[model samples]
Target: MRAQRKGPRRRRALITGSLGALVFALLTVNILLGSYTVTIPDFLAMLGGRTIPGASFIVMETKLPQALLGLLAGASFGVAGAIFQSMLRNPLASPDIIGISYGASATAVAAVVLFGVRGAGVSVAAIIGALVVALLITVLARGRGGTGLILIGIGAAAFMQAAVTFLLSRADLRNAQDAMVWLSGSLNSANWERVAILAVALLFLLPLTAAGSHQLHGLTLGDDTASGLGFNVPRARLLLTIVGVLLAALPTAAAGPIAFVAFLSGPIAKRLNGGVASLHLAALVGAAIVLAANFAAVNAIPGISLPVGVVTGALGAPFLLWLLISSNRANQGG
Candidate 1:
């Protein structure tokens, strides 16, 4: 018994620690290795209030903010995606796959194109859009089964996507370009302000996620089972759904829906951690994906620093098709 318990604990710790270290290394590289390289000693000196000529500005102002935002946004997307997938028992139920991210994107685009909204207003619009879509999905799917909910969410995603397209077409050239760039999700606009907002949001959401995590776990056992285990199924689901929506939305606001990090993170983490829906692992995987993808985007091509979304989208689309194929085959077999 002791051995059994220790084995899983040790394994979990190993996976967690290894991923944590990888994320740290990637972050360090992002901060220190760019067009201008800053040595560790100089980095430490910068932290200690001594400024190097070009290194200080590049590392402190550019790389650090971008890397931090990527980490936070990636973790947020991962946690939200994990919550939705685990609770709904559907891989396609991720906020990105469903309407939540689409809603946020659509609203943000509209705000940019139509209302000339930028900066934090776009973020607020995104959160509102996600919440509205969540409510719409829930209300519409109240009596319908899981399939109905998924379908509705997909439909919503499609509609909002169309909305974004139409708005982009109507906008002037300048607004269109700016909106398109933002929608493509670059870390170029990252700064201390966005990082701070996202961090504080995460700090606030953490306790809420922890408080409801117990109920979330219970929920995976089915509504009846969860109720028998003393969870109020409706409340738990609502709490988690809200949590998931906010998690997905806030990151989208900060990073412009960085293309499938949320969708990819949960399953990747679960596979990595031996079939457990580990949120922390998912968060780490999310951070790693964004960091690595951004690194590649910056250095992968000559004369162009592609947006982070481009790389993630290129990676995620194939995996998504694979998932759909696998799920279809499983259904046929079953």
Candidate 2:
């Protein structure tokens, strides 16, 4: 039996690793192949600290930063999804499902339209808004069932959606159109400075995730059990909530809440790895999905570009509905 289990595990590891490598290589090629094709030799020489004037600026300005955003956003969404699913003990408890992205989007849009805030200020507002909604959901669901929390999150998300609709209705036509674009995610206009900001967040969050891995494992048990295990359950939860909100918020701020990457990454990783629980695997899968999706979004069609959010939503919405249906059936049978 052990040998049989080991065989499947080895196969899964090999498959997951192959998938990750292929995704990364494809993303690299896509990044280099856009608009002006920078040959492999020139691209390497440019990165190796030798100046190929136009190539250096193009690499520095365009591909490098966007690639970094894709990486950071993908990793953040992936890890956040894993943490949320584990904490809520529900596969459907991802931030996207719980309306974390909606909260961020609502607040950022409010900032842009009502307050005229831009740049880092928009990001900060989105973070604050997401935290507020997350707290409300947590507080309202305290001492209640996990299903209660899920329901409350849905309500919060709906409220955010309404708010966005209201804002769009009130705005002028051009502004409304622009708002529509943001309501869906886009990474096309990202700059090097945005990349720098996301990198800083990753620098902090990745190490923090490493240190908190043990706590996350404890969380897979019931709260009481986790508390009994010497984990500060409330504090740990608070930290996780903050991490998740920021993870969702930062990307929303930069890329406009690309939907469903956060929702899909954990499950896809689990499925691909045959139920492995490694956060690293989840991150890898998340990065692969985002980069791969972006590559398709950028190059899949001519004369028109689909946003990353659109591609993810196209895939995520149907899957999310299926999940909801499956959960309902299981509950009925139980």
Candidate 3:
């Protein structure tokens, strides 16, 4: 009886711990093993305020912020994706697939390319953009249920992607270069300010998400079941959607919708956790994915540093195809 009671909890803890360790390892690797390697001892010294000539600048300004933002943004995308996927009971319900990330990307591009907005203003535009898209999706899918909402979201994503392309085409070279970051999702511009903004945003947003995540299991059982289980379907779904949008949007604003962090995190975490959906596990998996991808992007070529999104996009495309194939087969089998 005692072992039975502890079995699930033990498995949960083991998986969570393993993922947390992976994220921490990736974070350290991203920080300590970069273009300019900082020996672990020297890295410690630097963290303790002892500057090691050129190493201090690289470590302090570039790798640290880059890795930190990657971790936070990854976690946000992961948790947000997990929320939406669990709530809608569909893998295709990811913020990336359902247009929330693209909505943020489109507005951020427009803010920078058309209005000349920069700095935190772009982040503001991104959050507002995601909210607007979520609202539009809700309105259009009011009577249509989850499938309707998902289809509408996908359409919105296509439109937003086109908008991003169109805006890029109209901008001058300098502006185009800037807008390109949002389009491809680069972490090269990561600075302390950007890191702080994302960190603060998550500090407030994560608690709300954790609170709402409790209802996800109920939601996965469908609207009627959820309501029967005493969950307020509409209100809870609305709150989760708004929170999920902001989670994906703020990160997109900070990092330019970095590929499929939102799309891949939940499914990957579920697989890792023995097919149980754990948002905490997903967040850690997200951090690990981004950090690992960033490390590969930087070291894959001697001189070429690709945008982080490029690597993730390359990886996610194949997975997306596989997911579709496998899902179709399963449906047919059923």
TM-score, one value per model: 0.97, 0.90, 0.97
Across residues 1-334, which tens digit of lDDT does each residue of candidate 3 receive? 9999798789889988888898899999999886778788898898899978899999999999999999999999999999999988888889989888888988988999889998899999999999998899889989998789999999999999999899989999999987786578778889999999999999999899888877877788889989999999888988898888988999898888899888899999998777889899899988888999999988899888889999999999999999899988998995
Model 2, residue 325: C-alpha shift (Å): 2.2
Q: How accurate is candidate 3 locally (lDDT)?
A: 0.89
> What is the model-wide C-alpha lDDT for candidate 2?
0.81
Pairwise lDDT winner, candidates 2 and 3: 3
Error of 1 at 193 (Å): 0.8
Off by over 4 Å in 1: none
lDDT of each: 0.90, 0.81, 0.89
lDDT at position 9, candidate 3? 86
What is the per-residue lDDT of model 1 for residues 36-57, given as tens digits with 9 covering 90 to 100?
5788998999989998887788
- For model 1 the local lDDT of residue 70 reads 93
Worst 10 residues of 3 by lDDT: 177-186
Candidate 3: segments with Cα more than 4 A from true spot: none
Q: What digit string (tens of lDDT, one per residue) describes model 2 on residues 54-107?
A: 878877677777777887788788888888887777888888888888888888
